[model samples]
Target chain A: MAVRDPAMTDVARLAGVSHQTVSRVLNGHPNVREQTRLRVQAAIAELGYRPNRAARALVTGRSQVIGVVAQNTTLYGPASLLAALEQTAAESGFAVSVGSVRDLDHRSISAVVERHLAHRVAGIVVIAPVESAGEALERLPKDVPLVTVDGDPHRPMPLVTVDQAAGARAATQHLLDAGHRTVWHVSGPSDWFDSAGRIEGWREALTSAGAEIPPLVPADWSAAAGYRCGQMLARMPDVTAVFTANDHLALGVLRALHEHGRRVPDDISVVGFDDVPEAAYFIPPLTTVRPDFGAVARASLEMLLTQIESVSGGALRETIAPTLVARRSVAPPPRR
Target chain B: MAVRDPAMTDVARLAGVSHQTVSRVLNGHPNVREQTRLRVQAAIAELGYRPNRAARALVTGRSQVIGVVAQNTTLYGPASLLAALEQTAAESGFAVSVGSVRDLDHRSISAVVERHLAHRVAGIVVIAPVESAGEALERLPKDVPLVTVDGDPHRPMPLVTVDQAAGARAATQHLLDAGHRTVWHVSGPSDWFDSAGRIEGWREALTSAGAEIPPLVPADWSAAAGYRCGQMLARMPDVTAVFTANDHLALGVLRALHEHGRRVPDDISVVGFDDVPEAAYFIPPLTTVRPDFGAVARASLEMLLTQIESVSGGALRETIAPTLVARRSVAPPPRR
Candidate 1:
């Protein structure tokens, strides 16, 4: 019969202290007293006990943990991406450790990356949606296994992101096909790559149709901001169609239109991106874009694993296209 | 003048390799060959370079990092708590590392706790809102500084949570105050603590008023489930008031009632919980409960800090009460 390996409980018993003390001593925690540290060390030596496998993996730099850097946010797009990535990593027998940063600036991003590297994580993924994060990504050593999601398109980095422009174009063309001559847009924060890509796509679609472009309405990714912009749109009689950067914005716009006595699809039509789960329950069920977050996660992991196994980094890029879900929110403009 | 501390980049310059290689050697990463490791070590000794403050903190076990264990979910409640906690921690000059789990089962919780211990995190916070996570919390060593958020109330562990029962009672009482004989309820998943607490409060309010207790309409936390239950409620002639466990459920209920030609506040009234950002934009605008997540987070951190400073464990419990926000969704029962 094989001998059973010594456990943490055994170390606790031999050291004449609690398991937590033994853990503290092993981790070099400052709280443990000198006497307790000596006792735990003696016990560890006596039993030939080793710390947990994860600690051992840290020493070997082969931990089955993927480090992710993400902003601490409750927004739908980034939050959905994180959840999908965690699920995908788990399915592939890897645990995810997220270093939550308050901001995506260079200093914050660099600090999180250094900590992740110190832990010797297998690979690192940074969810860089804003332009401020670009400089940090460029500064990191190119030899590290890294990938950026929803980062700058011009950056020559390994990336997997949603085709935001494609989704925007589709939403715009759908409204045009409904006999609307022009479509107004409610965009997200100006600094975000998602907002830039979406604005570009909407413009491309209108230009292709030879439709007149209206002045852009800029807003942050919040319902209150959307409502404020919606109030302005509701006062314009010629604004027959509106496409919002996200579903929450669409909800605000719908509320404003309702308050203004403008019936959806009967007076002014609306379209939104990110078909959030509650979109279908809206007063007039929302027609929106649904990005394949699961697909983006899978592609990201596959690209990362290839780099991890080969011990080389490549400038790979994959963009998943979003589909437009048709619902009651869009219709032909009412006759004058 | 003080001599500047040697940096990682300085070590790289001495080693004649990329900065990443020096990091790998310091982290004990296995990818580097013996020759490279020796060269990096020699350079480190020559330059007297210290890896970084964080790595040094790891040795002393005095890292200013708080480890948080949360399930990988996009659900509004848990997500909001996490985001708020992260913000509070950042304000207090602490970085947060989240270990995302797939389930709240005992084994999963234990594994995450062990990992946090290995990293010597200042303290651990587990966002356990399910029944299965109870046993693991009990089994942990008594000396560790730990606190649970939205965890089992029966467990003898330090915890800070939203007052779910109080919020539900307020919602029910608000409807009753509007001259409704009784209020019907659509609940969340049976196993969740939030659902159970909401049910308890609802029953208490009805019993206190000497009103008939209608059988609960069981549903999960989804607009789809709410819609299904709403369809049944709409067909019942005596249904005048409804209280749902969450805002998304209320949204679905509102949609279903609209489809059935039931005018909100005129034919039926509704109340909800969470007061999600979109609640105010819901069709008639939803009257809901707003749990102070920031307060809960601040209290949790304060309790954890107390324990860490004293190097002791206590069964501290704090529950932050939620307030009801009145909106257009509630009105006096239509004249019988």
Candidate 2:
């Protein structure tokens, strides 16, 4: 029987520090104080810890490929993030092999990660956007260079994602600033972190403004769902302003309102998120939030590269803030 | 030095039939005659042509993964196809490894294909939608079981695609049927096969009806481009009906017409393609062409599976016809 090579846990144990601290020292993260760094170095030297994956990659000249694990879907946010990441990787002279899974479940994610490891990928990025993916990320080998995008904020993992809460707050605040007494929200599926974060921000904004929080209208990320929610809201006399989770939802709301003869901005103000390319072409031209997917992609690549070149690191997090793109859809409430 | 294994071409030469016929026989296709099937089997035995990839996969129990090569894009059509393909492949108990390239050019595609080969994927699917991808598809080694989706019609390769011409004709005829004397057309980027096929169908519909052919308005697949074209069309008194290549373009056209005070279906009518999720939510729900992406994905997988289980064959094709989804965007042209 072959003996397994020494692992990151061994180094951490010898160094008298947590696994994350060991990773932080290995990654040369600036926050590691001198004493801890020296302790980690001493442990590494004593154990002959070589960070064999990176070392082997350097010797074999096979570090030009980066593995990406993402769910196969046409939804704008994940699709855009994947595209942006591929572009950024290409620009940096690396090829991307995306192991596309049917779901972000543990079994699917683990299978893809195992395949990536078999191919000797220099580093890995998992576009884990849902709650189910968090457990799998935690269970992955700690020695492997890894990063997560749009994953659980509570997980101790390297992650880069758009500030979903900030964007949602901005959208809600924009609608309230237009003199609406209170704003209603149509949110995305509950399983997604993006959805939860946006819901949080929407509630935060409403609470901060001392406005009554209306009952949440839940819908999946679809124009059809939005239209259904819109139909219900269109009949409500007090529904003066709406902030949807995304632009497609806003389009549905706009159409339902149109069919009911409720004019936009005059009768009801609307704001949306994700500022999709066609948002400006919507009936009233959607006022929406634009997350910096490019910045997030770049930051993710930088973090992954740091791990590939050195070792692992602590749960490094970078949240790119989104800007509100105010278009024609926002206005003061109707004179009742 | 190792001797090269006998390839499919060798078997084709041994048998007096075309490469495609040999493939048809090996796949147990009903079209192959009994005599031809016997001859191909005899040739296979004589040449010791084992279809080594599939045989090895069987022996090693490693045929559960399918490799897919697609460009990284957020565009609706290609993205939908990719998603559907992954879903279909998953249903068949196969994992999908996507090789995402920046371009479908020879270098990028060839590199990805090589990676897939190294991984010993059961079969490969290339989502080649652009003209540039044609040359690379043709250049790949013939022994690999491969299929191309949305590739060039002229290429001698296994391909499965939506019938763009048929969908365009349906959209054009829908407008013509609504009493528009003639329809002005806005097309997608010229380099795409989807664009060319649409132009052909649009022209054929007009010519068949004895309607004067309007000069083509060229634009990329963007709402911004559609807005520019719509501005021009809205200014023309004779432009009563406009057909855009996709739903986003229709949205832009609608917005421009709205801005110019041209009420849709009253002053002018409009039709678009791709029946996007948000199309029905457009101010006056759009009438567009809905290509069956799921059907195309299923057909592509079936074709690839047939080839993977047998020897390489000649070009096989499957073109799924899309349907016209009528909504509020079309109406009779207004009287002068």
Top candidate, metric DockQ: 1
Model 2 per-residue lDDT at A162 = 84
DockQ of each: 0.27, 0.21
Q: Model 2 chain B — which ten-residue stretch has the worst lDDT?
A: B52-61
lDDT of 1 at A171: 99
Stretches off by above 4 angstroms in model 2 are A1-67, A91-95, A99-124, A139-143, B1-67, B91-95, B99-124, B136-145
**What docking tier does model 2 reach?**
incorrect
**Model 1 chain B — which ten-residue stretch has the worst lDDT?**
B53-62
**Collision count for each candidate, in order:** 0, 0
Across B31-95, the per-residue lDDT of candidate 2 in tens digits comes to 98888889999999897564433332434434456888887568888788877887788677565
- Report, in order, each candidate's fnat: 0.38, 0.48
Give candidate 1's error at residue A7 in angstroms.
7.5
lDDT of candidate 1 over B1-336, digit per residue (tens): 225446678888888999989989987899999999999999998975655434445354445567888885688877878778777876775556676778889999887777666555678888988888888888876656789998888877898988899999999999999999999999998888889999999999999999899999999999999999999999997999999999999999999998899989888999999989889888888999999988999999989888877855554999999999999999998996
